[model samples]
Target: MLSLRRILTVSATLGILLFLSFFLEQRLQAVAFRVVMLSGIAVVMAVSLNLINGFTGQFSIGHAGFQAVGAYAAAALTVYGHNRIFGNLPRSGQLPDTLQGFLLGAPAMICALLAGGLFAAVVGYVVGLPSLRLKGDYLAIVTLGFGEIIRVAVENTEAVGGPRGFTGNIREGIYIPNLTSFFWVYLMVVVVVVVSRNLRFSVQGLQYLSVREDEIAAQAMGVNTTRVKVNAFVLGAFFAGVAGALYAHFEQSVSPTSFGFVRSFDFVTMVVLGGLGSITGSVLAAVVLTALPEILRSSLGAEFNQYRLVAYALLLILLMLVRPQGIFGRGELRLDRLFGRKGGGGPAGRDNVEDQPAATELR
Candidate 1:
C-alpha cells in the first residue's frame, strides 16, 4: 500500500540513520551519546503525548504508566528469553556489530519492542474507556492515579525484582541484551514525527482536532468523539511503550521509581513548553529539555548539579509567563513561512487560508 514517494522517503531516512549511527558511535563521547539517546527517547514520549493532549484535547497525564508497562514487558522478555532466542551469543554493552549476531538478535529485539507497544496499547484502551469520558482536570486526576497505581504495583511485584529493580544478572543466565542503538532510537523518532505530521493533515486527524476544539460540536458533526479519543490514547500509549522499551534496553535496567508521576509531569512539561499542537515544537522542546540538564552538569561541577532543577523550573516559569500559548501556538515551523514566500499564492496559499479558521480556534 505504500506509495513510491513514501518508500523512497523511508529508504533515504534509513540510509541516513545508519550512517549517522555508525559515525556517532565511533566518535561521540560516552556522556554525549547517552544524552543524545535520551533525547531521542524524550522526543518519542513528547510527540506521542502530544497526540492525546494536543491533538485530541484530552488532558490525560499518566503517560508514565503506559511507559512503565512497556519497559517491564520488554525487559522481562529479553531477560528471560535471551538464552533461548539468542543461544550462545555473548552479551555485550552495545549492539553486536557483526552480521551473524545482528541476524540472530535483531528479530527478537523487534518482537520484544512490538510486544511492549501492544501491551501498552491494551492498557491505554482499558484506561481510556472510562477515563476519556471525563474532561480536563477530572481526566488528569484519573490518569495521575493510574500512574501511581502502576508504580505501586511494580513495587510489590517480586518477579520483576519489586523495589529492588530489574537488572538482568549475567550469572543467573538472565540478560537484557543491549539492543538499543542510535539507529533504532532515531528511527522511531522519525516514524513518530512523520506519522504525527501526516495525521495532522489527514481526515481522521481533523476529527481529533474537532474534538479538541469543541467536543459537543464535534459529536454534532457526526464525529465519534469517544472513538477518536480512545484511538489517540492507544496510539499515544503504543509509541510511549516503544520509547520505554528503548529506554530500558539502553539503560540496561528497569525500576518502579523510574516511571512515576514525576516522569509523566516531565513529558507534560515538554508538551506545554512546546506548542500544544506543533510536532516540531515538541521535538525541539524534547531535545532542549533532555540536553539542558547534561549541559548544566558539565558546566557546573557535580557538586552543583543538584541545583539544576531550580534553573529548569525558573526557565519554565519564565517561558510560561512570556508565551503561555507556547512557542508556536499550535502552528508548525516551515521553511516557507520563515522566508515569507506564502507558497507563491497558489494552491498551498488557498490551503493555508482554508486552514486559518481551525488554526485560530486552536490557538
Candidate 2:
C-alpha cells in the first residue's frame, strides 16, 4: 500500500513533467500533456460531484452552474488582463513569447479561478439551504430548477456578453503553465480520486453517510444533518468551479450553452452510472463518458453527430436495467483492497436502517 505522502510525492513529480512538456518542442509530447490536463479537470468534476450525489445521497443537477461560474471567472480575467497587456485576446494557435519565462506570471488568472470557485460556493449555499428540505425527486427537481435559473441568468447578464456569449484570446495560467500535459491532468485526476477516497474513509465521511441514510436517525444520533448537507454541496461546487476555470482556459471560450441543464445531467449520469456512492465508479464513469463522444466523433466523423446522444441515452437505459445500483452501488471497485484504506464499511453502517420493535406483553 502506498502511503498518502508517497502517493502525493509521485503525483507532484508527474505534474512537474507534464508542466514542462509544453516547452519541449515535440508536438506529440505537447498533445499528450494537454490530454493529461483535461483528464485532471474531469477528475475534479467527478470527485466533487461525488460528495453530494454519492456520499450525501442528494440528487443535485446544478453541478454545471458551478462550472460556469469558474469558467467565466477565469475567462473574464484572462481576457481583461490580456487586453491590458497585449491590447486584446490572442488569436487561435498563437503562443506567448514569454512561455519560457516565469510560470504563473499572470497572477490575476489564478485569482479568477479561485474567485470563480468561491462564487460557486456562494451559489451552493443559497441553493442548498432551501433544497435540503426536500428529498428524492423533489430535491432533484429543485436543483434542476436552480441550474436552469443560473443558465438563464447568465444569458441575461450583458456584462458577460449575455445570450450571445463571450470568447477571449486567453492563455493558460503558469501555476500550471501551457506545460499542461496528459501526465499533469492524469496526475491531478489521481489526486482528486485519492483525496476523495480518503475523505470517504474519514470520520467526517461516516457522518455524511449517516445523513445520507436517514436524516431522522442521524439527528437522533446527534449528527447535524443540515451542516453536513451544506458542506457537501458547497465543497463539491468549489471543485466544480475550479474544473470549470481550467476548462474555460483550456478551450479559451465561455458560453451559456456550455453550462446548460444538459451539462448538469451529464455529470449526474456519470455519478449514477458509476454507482451512487463509489469513488472508483465515478472515476471510471467520467473517463468512459468523456471519451465516448470523442471516440464516436473520430470514428464516424460528422455523420455520427446525431447518433452520439442516442447512444448515450441507450447506454444509460441499459445500465439502469442491468445494474440499477450502478457499477459499484454503495461499494467501490478496487482491484486490491489490501493496498487501499478501508472505506465506511458499506451501506449497513449508515443510520437509515430501522430497527424492528419487540412485541408488547399484552399482545
Candidate 3:
C-alpha cells in the first residue's frame, strides 16, 4: 500500500517534469537541447563509475564496453523487434501516443533502456567474476582488454549493422522524438543519484567501503568481499547500460566506434575530476565536462574546440599538483559546507585512521 505522502510526492514531481519539459521543448534550440540531454547521460556514467572506482576502490576502466552493450541491445530491440512484433514501422499519426504510451509500438524507449541495462548487468557479473582475482594495474589492463574485445566482437556481428552501425531505421518518415528528452534524462539522473547515495549510506554500502579500505581486513571481519565487489560491478554496469540506451535513442543510432577507448577515458576523467567516492562531485564534473566543449564550440568557434582536450589535461595536471584528491577530496559540497560545517573522518566520517600500539609511543 502506498502512503498518501508518497503518492503526492510522485504526482507533484511528474507534474513539474511535464511542465519543465514542455516549456523547454518550446523554447530551446536543438544544440542546447542536445547538450542538456548528453549531460544527463554523462551524469549516469560518471556516477556509475564512481561506485566501482571511487567507493569500491577498483580501477577497472572498460566502461565503454558496458555502454556499447546497452546501446546495441536497446538499438537492436528498437530496430529489429519493431519489425518482428508490429510487422511495420511506427506511423507519425500515432507517434505522439506511441511516445507517450508505455507500449513499444517501437517499444517505449524505456523498455529498450531497461532491457539493455539488465543485459549489461548480467555481463557485468560474468566479467566481474574473473576481475575479482586481479588488482591494481593488472585489473585495469584486463578490463581495458575486455572493452577492446567487446568492440571487435560487435564490429564483426553484422546483425546490428556491425561496422556499418545500427541505423535504427523506422521505415523512413516515422518521426521518433529523441528519447533522451529532458524529463526522461533528468528522471534517470535523479534516480541514479538517489540510489548511489542510499547505497553509500546503507549497511551493504558499509561493507563496500570496508572492502575498499582493506580486502583482507574485510574478509577477517566476515564481510563477503567477493559479493560486494561483484555487486558493485553489476550495479555500475546496469547504470552504464541505461546511459548507453539513452545515447542510442538520442542519436537514433549505435556503432561500435562510439564506445571506444576514448569514450571510456572520458568517463574516467569525470570520475577523477569529481573526487572519488563523492557523488556530488561526480555530478558536477559530468555537467561541466560535458557542457564545456559545446560551450566553447558555440562561443569561440569550432577551431577552439581542439583546445578542450588540452584544457582538460592542463586542468587535471593542476588539480593533481594542488589538490590530488580532486575538487572535493573524498568530501562533498553540501549546503552545510556553505554554512560552515567542518567535517572530519572520525568515527562518523569515512577516512582511514591509524592506531599506535599501546605503551610503545614513548620509545
Candidate 4:
C-alpha cells in the first residue's frame, strides 16, 4: 500500500507538470518550444543511459541504434495505420486544442509509442546478450558496432525511404500526424524520473550498484550480474525508444543519419558530464546541454555561431578538470539537505544513508 505522503507527492508533481505543459505551450515562442521538447527528450535519453552506464557500470554506446529502431517503427505504424484507425481525421497538428480532439487522437498515439518501445526492448535484449561475455571497452566496441550496423541496415531499407528519410507521402494516404505535445513529453519525463528514483533505492538497484562496483565480487555474493546488466539494457532501450517515438511524431519525419554514432556520443557526454548514477544531475545536464547551443546561436548571432562548438568543448574540458565526478556527483539535491536540516525518517532518509559512501568516494 502507498503512503499518504507518497500519494501527495505524486499528485503535486503531476499537477505542476500539467500546469507547465499548458502554460509553456501557449506562451513560449516557437524556438523555445522546440528547445523545451528537445530538452525533455534529452532528459529521457540521459536518464535511461544512466541506468546501464552509471548504475550497471556498462559502457554500451548503441543507444542511438535503439532510438532509430523506435523512430522508424513508430513512424511506420502511425503513417500506415492513420487511414484505417483514424478514418480521415485531421492530423494532430490541425486538431483544435479541445478535450474532444485529445480524446480522438490519444489512443492511436499511445499505441504507436508503445509499439516503438516494445520493438526497441526486443532489440535491446538481443544486443545485451553479447554483454554476458564482454565487459568495459569490449562491450562498448560491440555496441558501437551494433549502432553502425543499424544505421547501415536502415540506409539500405528502401521501405523507410532509405538514405532520404521517412516522411510520409500525403498523396499515398500515409502521413505521420503531429501527435506529440508538451504534455506527452513531460509526462514521460516525470514517469522516467520517478521510476529511476525508485529503482535507485530498491533491492534490485543494490544488485546494479554491486555490478558497477565489481562484477566478479557481485557474482560471488549471489547476484546474477548477467541478468542485472541485461535488464538495464532492456529498460534503457525501452525509454530511448519512447523518446525516439516522441521525436518522430513531433518532427513528423526521421532520417537514418539522425541516429548515428555521433548522436550516441552526445548522450554519453551528457551522462558523464552530469555524474554517473545521478538522476538529478542527468536532468540538469540534459536541460543545460540541449539549451546551450540555441543560447549561443541567439546570443552570438550567425557569424560567431561557427565557434560555438569550440566554446562547448572548452567548457566541458574545464568542468571535467575541475570536478571530474560531475556537477552533483552521485548524490541527489534535496531541499532538506540544502536547508541544513536532517532528512526526516522514511525511505528518502534511508536512501541518503545508503548513497553517501559512493558520493564521498567520488568527492
Candidate 4 overall Cα lDDT vs. reference? 0.82
Candidate 2 error regions (>4 Å): 1-37, 81-109, 169-188, 335-363
lDDT of 2 at 312: 69
The 10-residue segment of model 3 with minimum total lDDT is 354-363
Best by lDDT: 1
Model 4 lDDT-worst window of ten: 354-363
Model 1 per-residue lDDT at 4: 100
Per-model RMSD to reference:
3.0, 7.1, 5.5, 3.6
> What tens digits encode model 1's per-residue C-alpha lDDT throughout 1-363?
999998998899988987888789779999899899999999999999999999988897899899999999988888777668655545543456644545556776797789789999999999998889899999999999999999999899887889998877556756677778888899999889989988887778788888888888877777778899999999999999999899898888899989987789789888988988878889999999888876667777695556655766787799889998888778887777778865663465322522222322221
lDDT of 4 at 53: 91
Candidate 3 off by > 4 Å: 84-107, 169-177, 299-307, 339-363
lDDT value for model 3: 0.78
Q: Each prediction's Cα lDDT score?
A: 0.84, 0.69, 0.78, 0.82
Question: Clashes in model 2: which pairs?
Answer: 32-182, 33-181, 33-182, 34-181, 36-182, 36-185, 104-174
Q: Tens digits of per-residue lDDT for model 3 on 244-321?
A: 888887787788899988789888888898888888889999999998877778888979857766787898899899
TM-score of each: 0.91, 0.78, 0.86, 0.90
Report the number of the highest-TM-score candidate: 1
